[model samples]
Every structure is written in C-alpha cells, then in structure tokens.
Target: MILTVTLNTALDITYRVPRLRPHASHRVTEVTERPGGKGLNVARVLAALGHEATVTGFVGGGTGRALRDRLAAVDGVSDALVPVSGPTRRTVAVVDESTGDTTQLNEPGPHVSPAEWAAFQEAYAGLLGSASAVALCGSLPPGVPVGAYATLVRAARAASVPVLLDTSGEPLRRGVAARPDLVKPNAGELAELTGSHEPLQAVRDTRRRGAHAVVASLGARGLYALTPDGEWRAPAPDRLAGNPTGAGDSAVAGLLSGLLDGEDWPRRLARAVALSAATVVAPAAGEFDAGTYEKLLARVSVDRVTS
Candidate 1:
C-alpha cells in the first residue's frame, strides 16, 4: 500500500463558464466538488491505477466533513485523516470553456493546533509500517511547523520505506535536505528552490541539496528526470487543452507506481508524462481520461540526456 500525507486538505470546487473577462460576471454552466490537496489528488490517481492508497491529513468542520464524504465513495482509497478544530479550506477553479483557460483562487487552510499536529505525527508513523512507499505533499497549514515534511521524511526513512515529496517553498527546501527517495517539483518551484531557471542545472542542484533523485515538471514540454541510473527527458506527444489542475499530482502517482513496479527510469518518466497529459484533457480536477492515458503511454518519448 502507498501512504500519502496532505497536511492542508481542501474541498476543490470547479466552475465552468462560457468565457472569463476581467472585472466581469459570467454564467456558470457546471460545478463539481471533490476532496483535494496534493496528496489527496495523488491518492485518487493511484487508486484509479488499481493501487491501494491510504490518505492521512488534517480535516475538520463542515467543509472537511463534506470532503470526507466524497472521499469515502472513491474505491481503493482509505481515509486516515486526523481532525482539527479549525475548518478546512476550499479552492475555486473557474474554467473558461471558450478559451480553455483556468483561473484559480485558493484559501489558506485551517489553523492546526499543536495537539492536532502531534496526533497526526503519531498516526503517520504507524501508517509507515504498512506502506511500501509514502508521499509527503502540499502546503503547510497555520501553526504546523515549517519543517513538518522534513520530520516526516526522516520517519519514513527510518522505517525503511521509500518516500516521495512534492511541495514548494521552505517546506520543500527543508524536506529535500531530509534525503527523500524522490522529489517532484514543477518549473517555478524548481527555480525558487535552486535559484536557477534551467531545468537540468536546477535538478542537479536539488540533488546536491539531498534528494536522492529529482523529477522536474516542465509544463507542456513534459518531464526532466535525474535519477541514480541516468538522466532523461520525456516529452509529451502533443499538447491537449483542458484543465491542468491535477497534472502534477497524476505525474507523481505515475512515478510512485512505476517505482513499486520496478520500472526503469525511461519507462517511469514516460508513464509520468503520459499521466500528466491525460489529466490535462480530463473533464474534472484530480482525474485523468483513461483512454487518453492509454494512447499517450505508447506515444511518449524518453530521450537520455548526455553531458
């Protein structure tokens, strides 16, 4: 089983409109809601790929309850979320149907008390015992320590479980130093962490900082991966227009699943790129179009990068 940790869980709400204009109101044609946050999104994708995933995070209040209700309906996923006093947050994504653009508004999640944080740590440690691999993902809620991911990474390492971390800012910096088995950061996050906009250089710098391997997402260009075996560039066959909200999470799911299956770096990167592209064309957030995924999996090209 794979364990995913999302400290700041959310209710993801999506609105579809004909078009979006600055300072203008538009009619909403559709709305969808789901349990969200980086780890939760990853868990959903992993479940869709026929893997058993266990999600642990902090959830509370009405919005939290609603999110949990939706999560319970998802097959192959187990809920192990801890409760906090403050209400969980919500993220709004407004999609422009005409232009295929998305505007996102995110809320700062609930404040987590020290007691709640402690309880979560205990639960996480126990979960590691049964997990083949673990993913520590997303932003830190108020009152949680900035070094939260770093702490979790150490726990996973000590338990002999391979860990993947996907986050940004200081949490990511500190987590990377904890020497996670893998780290996946998008372009902007990579620049922020390494102070270099160059993907290859940034990934090298990140590995030097302590991550055993680094997979940098290059948006439409696909993925750039630097692992122990070698370096490779996996590019998408074509750009598909749709909501790209959960693309990175899907990529994370791909990488984790590939690792468990003992796939080589080339095959793993190809799978990650294909899953990311599939998520872009999906109708909803945190989901990938299965048909698109199957087609792209065969089309994604992985080229080894040579010095």
Candidate 2:
C-alpha cells in the first residue's frame, strides 16, 4: 500500500459561476466539496488508478469528521488520519464557466500542539511499516515543525520505503536534504527553491540539493525529469485547456504508482503526463477523466535529454 500525508487537511469546496467579476453579486451555478490537501488529492488519484493508498496526517473537530465521512466513501483509500484538538481547515476554489479558470483561497489550517505532533509521529511510523511507498505533500500547518517532511522522509528511509516529497518554500528545502526518491515541483515552486525560473536548471539544482530525482511540472507542456538513470522531457500531445488545480497531485499519483511497480522513466513520465492532463479537463479537483487518461497515455511523447 502507498501512504500519502497531508499535514494541513481541509474540506475543499469549489464554486462555479457563469463569470467572475470583482465586487459584484453573482449567482452560483454549482458547488462541489471533497476531502482535500495535496496528499489527499494524490490519494484520490491513486485510488482511482486501482492502488491501495492509506491517507495520514492531522484532522480534527466537525470539519475533520465531515472530511473523514467523505473519505470513507472513496474506494481503495483507507483513513488513518491522526486526530488533534483544533478543527480542520477549509479551502475555496471558484471556477469561472466562461474561462474554465480557477481562483483559490486556502485557509492556514488549525494549530497543532507538541503532544499532537508526537502522536502524529507515532502514527506515521506505524503507517510507514506498511506503506510500500510514501508521499509527503502540501504545506506545513501552524505549530508543526518546518522540517516536518524531512523528519518523515528520514523515517520512511529507515523503514526501506521509497518516498516522494512534494512541497515548497523552507519545508521543501529541508525535506530534500533527506534524499527522497523523488520530488515533484511545479514551475513556480521550482523557481522558489532554486532561484531559477528555467525549469531544467531548477530541476538540476534541486537534485544537487539532495533529491535523488526531480520532476518539474511544466503546466500544459508536461513534465521534465532529472534522475540518476537519465534525463527526459515528456510533453503532452497538446496544451490542454481547463482547471489545473489538482493536476500536479495527479502526476504525483502516476509517478508513485509507476515507481512502486518498477516501471521505467519513459513509461512513468507517459503516465504522469497523461494523468495530469486528464485532471485538467475534469470538472472537479483531484479527479481525472478515465477516458481522457486512456486516450492520452499512448499519445504522450517522452524524449531523452542528452548533455
């Protein structure tokens, strides 16, 4: 089973409007809510791909309970979330029908105490024992240590579990030091980490910082990966148009699934790119259109990069 971690768990709510205009009242056409946070999003995609994924991290109060209830309904995903004293946060994503673009507002999440963090460590350690691979994802919530992912990566490494670290800012900087098997960062996040806007250079820099491998998500263009085996660029057949919020998470799911199955870089990149594009066209976050994924999987072209 794969383990995914979302330190700041949330109830994701999406609102759809005909168009978004500033400071104007508008009627909402639709609303969709689901359990979310980066790792949860990854778990959703993994489960949809017929993989058994256990979701862990912090959840609390009424919001947490509601999120858990929704999670319980998802197939192939097991809830092993640690409870805390504070309430789970909520994230709002407003999708405009006219443009199919999304505007997101995310809450900082509830504060965790020292004891609660300790409980989480114990829970994570136990989960690592069963997880074939682990994904450490998303932002750090208040009161959680900045090096939380680093600590978790170390534990996973000790247990002989391959780990993927997906995060940004200081947390990512520290986590990479633990030499996770892979790190998935989008263009912007890559820039923030390596101080380079050039995706290829940033990915190389990140690998130097400690990631065993780095996969840089290049939006509609697809993924650029730098690994010990070799470097490659996997581009989508075309630039897909739709909401791209959870696309990266889907890519992470694809990569993790392939990694655990011992697939080579080309096949993994093809799957990652296809899954990411599928999520873009899907109406909701953390979900991919199965038909679209199947159609795009063989179309994605992976090209080897030579120095």
TM-score for each model: 0.96, 0.96
Count of residue pairs whose backbone atoms collide, per candidate: 0, 0
Model 2 lDDT per residue over 127-203, tens place? 98888999999998899999999999999999999999999999999999989999999999999998998888899
Error of 1 at 219 (Å): 1.0
Predicted candidate 1 versus true structure: per-residue lDDT over 89-146, tens digit per residue: 9999998989878889999999998899999999999999999999998999999999
- For candidate 1, the C-alpha RMSD (Å) to the true structure equals 1.5
Instruction: Give model 1's TM-score versus the native structure.
Output: 0.96
* Candidate No. with top lDDT: 1
Task: Tell me the spans in candidate 2 whose CA falls farther than 4 Å from its real position.
Answer: 24-29
Q: What CA root-mean-square deviation does each model show from the true structure?
A: 1.5, 1.4
What is the model-wide C-alpha lDDT for candidate 2? 0.92
